[model samples]
Target chain A: MASITLDTVGKIYPGGTRAVGDVSIDIADGEFIVLVGPSGCGKSTLLRMIAGLESISEGTVRIGDRVVNDVEPADRDIAMVFQNYALYPHMSVRDNLAYGLKNRRTPRAEIDRRVAEAAVILQIGPYLDRKPRALSGGQRQRVAMGRAIVREPAAFLFDEPLSNLDAKLRVTMRLEIKELQRRLRTTSIYVTHDQLEAMTLADRLVVLNAGRIEQIGTPLEVYRKPASTFVAGFIGSPAMNLISRRAVPHLPVAAQAGTIGIRPEDLSVAPDGPIEMEVLAVEELGAQRLVHGQTGGERLTVAMPSDAPLSDRLRLSYRLGSLHLFHPETGRRID
Target chain B: MIENRPGLTLLAHLVLMAGVAIVALPVWVAFVASTHTATDFMSGTIPVWPGPHLVENYARMLDAGVSTSGTPPVGTMMLNSLVMALLIACGKIAISITSAFAIVYFRFPLRQLAFWCIFITLMLPVEVRIVPTFQVVADLGLLNSYAGLSIPLIASATATFLFRQVFLTIPDELTEAARIDGAGPMKFFRDILLPLSRTNIAALFVILFIYGWNQYLWPLLITTSSDYYTVVAGIKRMADAVDGLPQWHLVMATAMLAMLPPVAVVIGMQRLFVKGLVETEK
Candidate 1:
């Protein structure tokens, strides 16, 4: 329903500590944008700024056509689902879903209609009369979603809403949220530290490091061509390996910058390969094996078939197109 | 069951029983005295058994009271005590919860200064500021009223402090959620905060009720009319006979009545506390 535009957004605390730097993102209408990073990288802070929960130190945030820098959170026409669910503990599920509508002074019949619809959509209809304490963690999370769904706001802001659940439930709820967003077609900005969640749920993922935007691209796009060495290392499961260019007896050195990046899956075992490695260990992950070892004083991990031959003394090979080159001075991608 | 420590278990039971006996003995003695006649006490050694005047003395105190002392009936005095206790407990909770909410949620110049000012009142209790407080109450013409008996003692910093601690433990996410849900400050307070802190408020109410009911000097100083006399202070007025020995049996009966309501309130509030703990399913 709305496009969110964060133009040069930054947040600095009173003592001059920068939590987020100059970061800009254009989220198209109904696009699911995810802000993701490790802890203290300001992913949550950026999400909060967009939700109007935190004050922006610099820049303008536009929702639809209006600049909402000074608007109160209540007037901003947005709904947020928190990491802990933040359900009103004493209210019944029905009342929890109705709270926002009632606050907006919607009529009694309309409140009931929306609450019923949200409860059914979240499949929490049986818990409509029960307090949050009587519900399981997964149930509480659904109720939290129900609360947001009832609002039918311009945007949905999720701050790691599935992190508190068990791993299996997190997966289940993640799918539910993705499906719900697709159906509602509501513009959303989600924040998480889990790379898998970011990769699966986002239309575009914004990788953050040290309060600055490292890269922004679609899931497969970022996976195929990362914008920086940080994105190359952060986006993949086994993590891409970055080694000093001097470590290998390279035939064609792209730059004098002295860094090379290759994803674990791209490197394979080849008997006549040029790169010599001494295998330290191997992790058999059912379908694939993560081969960790050393080559010319640099540590590297290679993902190969589980059924493949394994040995202590091994040779590794990767295509020139799959190789990533970076300037050693900066972590930016140079490929 | 803990580590099969039978010796330690037996020692614990003995210590507990001794503690219970030591605490209950005074109330038992008061009960026994109230059941006896005046002649029963003159017999020097205090009787451990109940006498025949149990119903008579209580009924007399409740109905006629100590007529010679010129005070109102004990029934009227007990009602006064109930009103004062209920008002003080409820008023303190209302004032403290709102003040604690404001102090925790809002930021302004002198906010810390305001918190410290409220905290300093814990050191300056009504006992310490008795004279000036009484003067202020008199100047406001609040003497001989229920407000006179309760309001001067209800601005409690301890209750405010307890509520502040409770409010701080609430996650900041809750406030954000309420804001995003379109609840303003007061709406969030009424709909969310008050329900969440029910256990704290209930527990504080029990303590404040006893503190208010047991007040002696403040009520005695402020109330000149018999209509406003609380049970605890009224007992003293009844005990003061110019030239005669105090009516020992009636006085003991009045004392028993004075102690009953507060004990009952404490027990009742404790049940609510337990209920709150059990019903909190998480």
Candidate 2:
């Protein structure tokens, strides 16, 4: 296991288009760092650069104290699990696991031992001789993970590895990945566009926007105290509501603050409250209901109990000290 | 086809049977004629049934060839044709697959230009460039040799382009995965790309084998000695006999023998050929 450090990393394509710029993060040994953002946010590109699949355009990537800016992917001692799994279609699960070791000229007994161990760990021993095409998606996924595990590399890079699975399988695989990482304790950098996946899997979350780091902190820390309006809006489902200060002039916020942020759960129905919201629509999500409405010409959504009372118009009160303030011009959080 | 109409199915079967008969008639006639002596054709109407001379006529062609034309035995010509076909098919596949690999995977100056140059050769077949090609072969002292017969036809743009298409359909992720697995280019080619394209190679081999086997003009042009004669070219030479009428019985037997190998190749790899042509599931 090893720590990875990206120092002011940047990526500029040959066509003069910048994919990622001025990004840096320190990932501790055995810690899981998830780079999460929307599509085109360079999350995958950043992971690929660290994996040495793509060349770093600028800055140095240090893995276990060695700068790997020009290292080949094989020499970099990093294993990657791609979104598509990338298993060799022609190879059986056993051979697939052994291929990297075989290429490195690992001894026959040692390679066999490692491959067998990985198969046991992945519970794929039963399917060792079966080709990848014979396996189901989840089985193939395990084989892909087995390919990485047998390498015993310094770090593991995952690029949305669970995105191909169905929702239930994704949850199953997500838990399995977390458990596997915990057991192995390898330094891992995972990239995904799913905020929930990032939140559940990350030791520290690096939320990105437009190819730049929006904020980097533990999941709860970033969720509770978003450093920017983008983070506040993106890190949570039924995303934190950010409205213009003018939209809610009645709220007790600093006059200098230009925008107000409130988590959907922070708002409660109150008979006599400051903000009057006109009910628009309600989404039924079994245990909880999302109430989307307009208050003072700005859109706001509230997460309420499914049993909560509702009406055409209702007064809403936010918990004290729950308000998040930001600059309207820059959208940066105001402490 | 999906509707399962009985009447339409009957019509389809009738048309298909008609087509089969139309194509198989000449081959049937050739097979029947091979069983007869030269006097059988002299009587006028062609023999529709086998004659007692089948074994005698075939044995003569296989052992002594066409005595009048001074060609080698049918067995020798068949062996020569086998060598030439194997060389051309194997050589073409080897060169084209590697060129396609280089074209698809590597980055270098004039890579596109190199590919286009190979692609343009498809328009200039051996027939079009026969004079210059033959001159180059003669200058290199390859005439009347197996190298002369096969090497000139080895550089196939069709096979190269076909391989390029096959390689392109392979997902890019496989390449990235192989790189991460520490496989160099040739290792990746051998272990991954080659195995994945197994069916395609089989399909192309069948095609190129038949193509090489049926070659008449190129083999006829370069090989003047009877020792280097391919069966297909030798048949034409036997027919254009300088002395009397060509020995029809021996000639027919040679044609039958020449047709066997290609037909056998097709039959042997039919399943793989169909799979390669239709499905690229990987």
Highest TM-score scorer:
2
lDDT of 1 at B263: 82
The C-alpha stretches of model 2 lying farther than 4 A from their native spots are none
Can you give the TM-score per candidate against the true fold? 0.97, 0.99
lDDT of 2 at B138: 98
Clashing pairs in 2: none
Leading candidate by lDDT: 2
TM-score of chain B of 1: 0.94
**lDDT (10s digit) by residue, model 2, range A166-214:** 9999999999999999999999999999999999999999998988999
Q: Find the candidate with the highest DockQ and give its number.
A: 2
Off by over 4 Å in 1: B1-9, B275-282
DockQ of each: 0.75, 0.88
Per-residue lDDT of A86-124 in model 1, one digit per residue for the tens?
988878989888988898999999999888898789899
